[model samples]
Target: MGNRGGILPAVGALALLAACSAPAPAPVAQTTTPASASAKPPTTGPSSDAPALGPGPGSQPPTTPQPPPPNSPAEVTSACPFLGVTESSATMGVVLDAYAVEEAKTTQQDATTYHCTYASRTGGRQLLDLFVTVVPGTGQIPSLVTAWTKDCKGPAKPIGGVAGTTRTCSLDGADSGDVMVLVVKKSHGQTRLAELYVRPFTDEVYAKLAQLLTDRL
Candidate 1:
């Protein structure tokens, strides 16, 4: 349902509009966001109780800090190249033959972004898309994702490995239908935005990937 990094999204990018209705709706054509997509600084919350942190360093980022000039293809997202299942290590039972990986050249202007999509060879269904947006700050992402939990279906609970929280969203018939998971955690001086678009994943597997990614960062 989301773009796979750069300007263009690979196959099945649009087939993900609506998720989990009794009978899935006809897949609607959707356009991916351009590479220049910018993230809006999260809106101010109830007298914001969080403090921003200084940018130091975390796990080595995937790509070079300075990206190529605009309009060029972005580098492969750095942190989790281990994503995209194969014949040996499949994700959730789907043996994805291949995956589409791309990086956001200018995500949110100041943040770095990476996206990966794993799916069948013949196309149609995009089993999963792992999106990571690394913005420089501390507590902002955790605060933002936590704030979002208030309207979500599940309770926001803490998980080990990463310093963050996880929550599943409730449907308001306003989403793309994918049962997604939102995990926000902190590393040295950056906040991680790890968003997964998958067919309902258990908290265990979700935490595994979250830890793996956080460790990579």
Candidate 2:
């Protein structure tokens, strides 16, 4: 799975209906010419014949803000319980294996910042989710977590994997809380994961993810 770039948000849908009817046509002028010539014709109706109606009583009330649509497959795949594949391609650059329950949906988030999360059922006893967030230029990035409930049981430990040239440390930590950031020292800033939380920074994964960053960044 190549590291795909962000896509533009979709446009909103609009449904417009032409007014079912128009205001009654203005009353036509009736001419009553007296038999005795010399009666001057009446002036045009009320200067400007247009209607004198005031604004509609409650025309176009302000629309309430709408909630964003549920996260999409792209979003869920990115935020996974086990594996994530970039929308760009499915070449298996990253392989996520769920160590527990069958594929299912789970919600996760960070308390410190605004982040978008998407989770999916990757197979039996394993789930994977992705999170994409924008950090303030001067703000700090929150630590990532792998959380689950007490009743929910499985192998929630993090794993190490290789994605392209970059190395990642994929962990199964808390159920749905914060997790630490994984950094690689070799690249020295040439490659940094953007809007993502990952694990397993072995040499092979490092090379693969580095290449992905080069292409994606």
Candidate 3:
């Protein structure tokens, strides 16, 4: 009986020790996020589809566009400034009471021509006809002079004191007694061709008129 009592006490002590040495529960981990770290970085540049910025302060505004000048000459109603009814009458030695001016455009040659006619008032007989053609550039002046005087059968006669080419040809067959004079002048980047047909021709009259026309070109 005494040994049994000792064994019970030893068993009770071992149970108490085991209960005291048992491990406690493990601690739970906590995670914390910072407020600044979660937010996106501030935008530093414009977006791809953003509206374009206009001129800044003190910048000049847009200027108004200007229109271009006319390419063709204006309509001419009166006689040419250089040659008029009085001049025509003196050159033809006839009383030219009728006068008419016509403007024509030649598309093939890109030229504008003014035709001036002077005739007798009584019978309406045409006395003189003058044609003044204005081309755009001086490059065609030489070629035009060559083409105009091709059939004249002589070298080009340079008019005195005038920068141009002139040629005179007498009309044969039924148009005999009539003479034609062709004069080409270039000025201000333009080529001007002046052709005059006069009946009962005189060299002095033609030369004088050609000088006046080319000088004013």
Q: Pick the lDDT winner.
A: 3
Q: So what's the TM-score on candidate 1? A: 0.52
Measured by C-alpha RMSD in angstroms, how accurate is candidate 3?
A: 49.3
Q: By how many angstroms RMSD does model 1 differ from the true structure? A: 14.5
lDDT, candidate 2, 79-143, per-residue tens: 22222244211322544332211111111111111122221223121111222221112222111
Off by over 4 Å in 2: 1-122, 125-128, 138-202, 213-217
Clashing residue pair totals per candidate (backbone < 3 A)? 4, 59, 0
Tens-place lDDT digits, model 1, residues 1-217: 4322321112111001111111111222322432221233221111112221111243222231222222212323442353435421333554544334342232433554455434333434444555565555574553455433433335544554444455444222233344545565565576655555554445565566555444444
Better of 1 and 3 by lDDT: 3
Best by TM-score: 3
State every prediction's TM-score relative to the real structure.
0.52, 0.25, 0.54
Q: Which residue pairs clash within candidate 3?
A: none
Of 1 and 3, the candidate ahead on TM-score is: 3
